[model samples]
Target: MNFHLKITWYPKKRKSTISRRMVTFSYQVKVNGCNILVCREAFFSVHGLQNNQGRLKNLQKYLREGRSTSPKDRRGKKGNPSRKISQEAVQTVHNFINNIPKYASHYSRSQKPNKVYFDHDMSISSLYQEHYLKYCEQKNAPQVKVSKCRDIFNQDFNIGFKLPRSDTYHVCDEFQIQIKNDQLTNSEDIIRRLKIERDLLHAKASAGQNMITQLSKLAKENPEEYLTISFDLQQTFPTPRLTSEPAFYKRKLWTYNFGIHDCVSKKGHVIVWSEDEAKCGSDEIGSCLIKFLEIQKSQANILHIISDNYRGQGQNWATVALERSLVRTGKFKAIEHWFPQVGHTRPPCGRDFGRIEKHVKNRNPTVYTTHDWVTVIKELCKNNPITVVKMKQADFIDLTPLEKNIAKKDKHDDGSQFRFSEATAFRFDEGMPSHLKVKYQYTEYEEFRTVNITKKGRAHQKNNPFQLSWKYLKPIPICDKKLKDVMSLMPYIPDVLKGYFNSLSESKEQSDENETDVIDIGYIV
Candidate 1:
């Protein structure tokens, strides 16, 4: 039924050349019902024994049934003879024509980008060059083959080659093939993130509705039984944040502000301390939560804390351990912590920071010192009353957890992964609070470590207790110029802040405003 014509094996193309084992398939073609013998030899480069046999089988099928009634030759004459190549390879070649080209005029000159921003220097036909082909890796490598390199340029990346600007076809079709494999891959990630974002928005909406209904019911039934708290950190503030023309020159300082919000009542507190005083860490946030709880001792017996998924601050073992400890101490009936998917950080504290910024902008004052910032913020409280807790420089709580943030993965100790993100809910009940569960979702949960009631609750790894003596503080030294600059800005400083300032002076440090000149305070305005 197939290949009635004779087949032949050519042991060598030419005597001088290395022997090329080639197989030719012979078959008959039908043109106007007349049998015509046609033969094809395996390409010299296609080496595998099985590969040649498979190629022959395909040729036999094509021969048994003609592709068309009678194909014309290049000269438009009938049944002259024609050739066929791999459809995939042909398409790749077409793409190379439309998107990227295999050959281009190579420039030998200074660093200049090609049409596709590729700066490599090489001549056209470089892919088929003898030295490059022989030195370049396995015989099957793309660079070693004309069609393979053509396919790569056609389907792999968006980069294009350079050629002289002329009437040449290569110049005109440069960068025509934009495979955009990276963009395709990135689009998938974007789509996944968008889905998660939509899901987060829906979750927040549902949670808000539930919070309203549950809080209202709890208020009516148990009146003063529940509390909801939220928290977020703002970028540090640099001093000399004063509105000054080019003429007004001044010195600047730096500091950080951490704010917590009462979600239900819309009340907020901003915490800023001197560096020698406190470092903001998981433990410090927990301590702040404890202090906030102490202040609300009479307000609610049940606490519900909600914040975005900031690994170190809200969604970690230290905070969970702290909540459990508080519950075991009979501080509340129960504590429930909820975290939304990260990057959806729209909270009261964030809004209030905007308000504070607006207030500062409207005031249009020169913030030459930390006190100046405090005064501006304190003044902000007059019209926009937020409890501005000006923590004494020495009042920083040193007990931030030394442990790393946990990975939000849906896998076990055995190493297999599930199809979901990390836990979103953590709950502590009055009884067995220390052994509470951290839930990935409502349907999944993991148990926490239990602490003995007689012992103080402590975090694993390097944890210094909340209240360490200031004598233990390791000071980094700043230069005399920096010390003089600081003193020039504010003549009188509180003793604790002064010590912290001295430490900064020793280090010759600057905050992340990344500015050298204080008068560049044009942005502060």
Candidate 2:
């Protein structure tokens, strides 16, 4: 199978006539009698000759084996080793498992370690210690392993964990973490903080104040003259569970109705349904008010209905206007609507709705059907006692022993009696001028008359002065100065009465102008 070949080279040009002395070289060639091409020029050097012989040997071997010879094997025998878990990672996993009870559900029955199964031949003790024994109680039933727990916690509750996962347990833990880290000083940090700090501050501020101090200073100062009534709605949301279905699983249409109670009058009214589609329509608001007035008739005269600024709830300007219109039209009688200033409705008045919500939460009902839910709510409302205490000056007066001693040392002034005086008046006459000169005659006694009088020098012409009686007037015991000042700024009156008076004045002015226009047109014609 061995092949060897050789060749000699000679110059083509023989200028010296070397025909008789030819430079010829030859070598033994063995190729198994196979024809093969070999270059003669390649055998000039030992390196080239050796290379040619090696190539021939390789070709013969390739023919014998029927495949080409491969290049030298250059691949190394081993691969890169696996990365090892750090000590920090192991500690994190250990701590996570130790704190497992903190995150475990209150209803969870078992407190066992989690187990895991692997395809490879891992050490049984190591697998049991790391996962199986911790989660599984017996050999057959595999409890959720630490790795699986971590995955469940993360996937279900969006909590990140290292190891020893109990998904339910970790949810509360994650919430605690978020709450603890929420001390954001900047505006961006506020978005992360769940607990409101201002409410806590307010609670701390009002904790130890007396009853009188808590009431507005104005009411405390002049209790006899100004009557303070704190009005609120009750049972705003009567039934906590509208249906037997759980809150998270309930259908979208299931809604809860709130029962409104007034704290001052101990009256319970139901705001059963709100038209979610249409915002506070006039008819709905009027109906609610009319019902409230009808239910609580005895306290109707001195009543001041205070409520929040809910668009549909009867507290806005439109509601106020509608109440006045109804009164003027003689539909609603005796009741007056009074709205609290923008921020004054707090504590038991404006935020009474919040108390109702808390009570509803405390009385959680599992309602299976609509009728059952209604019956439950009706019973709850009927049994619930709403006690309204009439607040008086003495009731709020928290005169401590020290305060009593201090007051005893001071002299009490009883020179003046506190009384609210009428500050303004309105008169309407169709024939009266727009800017008529109003003159008041101060007499010892009050009287009303219509007089026709002649001017100082013009006896031929007569002018008629219409007199009006001021019934709501009280004698000013203090000073005419104080009286004048008080009168200048018209005292606060019921909105309904004010609207009625204004409407009367407008009608009178319109009629007077029409009369004057008619006289002018007749003269012109």
Per-residue lDDT over 421-502 for candidate 1, one digit per residue giving the tens place of the 0 to 100 score: 2556667787755344455542223443222222244443323333333321333232344356665644444455556455
TM-scores for the candidates: 0.47, 0.28
Over 1-525, each residue of candidate 2 has an lDDT whose tens digit, in order, gives: 656554333445677775754443344444687634444444324235554566545544454454645345434523643343344444444444444433322211123223221223333345446654544443333344456545444453322222233123333345445554536435445634434543332232233112213333434455432222343333322212333323334222122233445544334444443111111233334444444444554322222333433444444333433333333333333223333222221323424344445555777655422333444445444455332221111111111211111111111123222111110111112232111111122121332121111113422211111111221121112122322332222223234334532443353445455553211100000
Runs off by more than 4 Å, candidate 2 = 1-247, 254-259, 274-283, 326-363, 368-373, 381-525
Q: Each model's C-alpha lDDT?
A: 0.51, 0.34
lDDT of 1 at 4: 30
User: Model 1, stretches more than 4 Å misplaced?
Assistant: 1-223, 244-252, 381-384, 398-421, 442-525
Decoy 1 TM-score against native:
0.47
Worst 10 residues of 2 by lDDT: 419-428
Please report the candidate that would top lDDT against the real structure. 1
